[model samples]
Target: MVQESFEFVVYMIHACATKWNRLPSFVYRKLAESGCIQKFLVPNYEILHTQSTDFVVSDIEEYLNVRKVAI
Candidate 1:
């Protein structure tokens, strides 16, 4: 389930980038550096050996909030 959520987020990011004619890797790196992506995965590293779904969801929500503020 966690993997599925991660994949879904990745796919959405890629799709949005592609729609905007941006490079997915570049966008992904930018998001990562901004703490908008992938950072949540570390929180549950010990327990799940992967990111917790809850953490990932919260991270995404926080990312959206940040984006809303920036815009």
Candidate 2:
């Protein structure tokens, strides 16, 4: 991944962790297992990175929800 996208991934992982009251590692694992990192976040980085953190988090939540992934 490029530097910005990599950084964005890390930021999102931590953001999700905080919002979900989980550890960053756990969030990363959840996102990875659900393909959120690869299929959603990174692929949509150009647009997502421009949004508010809460907005992005909401988007992630929706994505996970549709996939039946609990936080």
Candidate 3:
């Protein structure tokens, strides 16, 4: 449940980024402080070799779907 909520927030962040071309600095800082920047967005590059904002959003969506199925 908690994970799902977190992923939803991450998805929203990426969705905003995709629309804006980049996340605002303040928003990015807040997300970084919350650890989402490191845990979800960063690790994706290590595993997939791509960290484009669109890819990040897709990754979060995929993760959320997988978690939903697990439930």
* Candidate 2: tens digits of C-alpha lDDT, residues 1-71: 78999999999999989988999999999899999999998899999999999999999999999999988
Mind giving the per-residue lDDT tens digits that candidate 3 earns over 1-71?
Answer: 35644565555575756654765564455456655556665554445433465665566556545545210
Q: Which prediction has the highest TM-score against the true structure?
A: 2
Compared with the true structure, all predictions reach lDDT values of 0.54, 0.94, 0.54
Better of 1 and 2 by lDDT: 2
Top of the candidates by lDDT: 2
Candidate 3's TM-score reads 0.36
Model 1, runs deviating above 4 Å: 39-71
The number of clashing residue pairs in each candidate reads 0, 0, 0
How close to the true structure is residue 11 of candidate 1, measured as C-alpha lDDT? 64
TM-score of 1: 0.47
The residue-by-residue lDDT of candidate 1 on 1-71, one tens digit each, is 37765766576456546654678876566567666645543343344335455554445546656766221
TM-score of each: 0.47, 0.97, 0.36
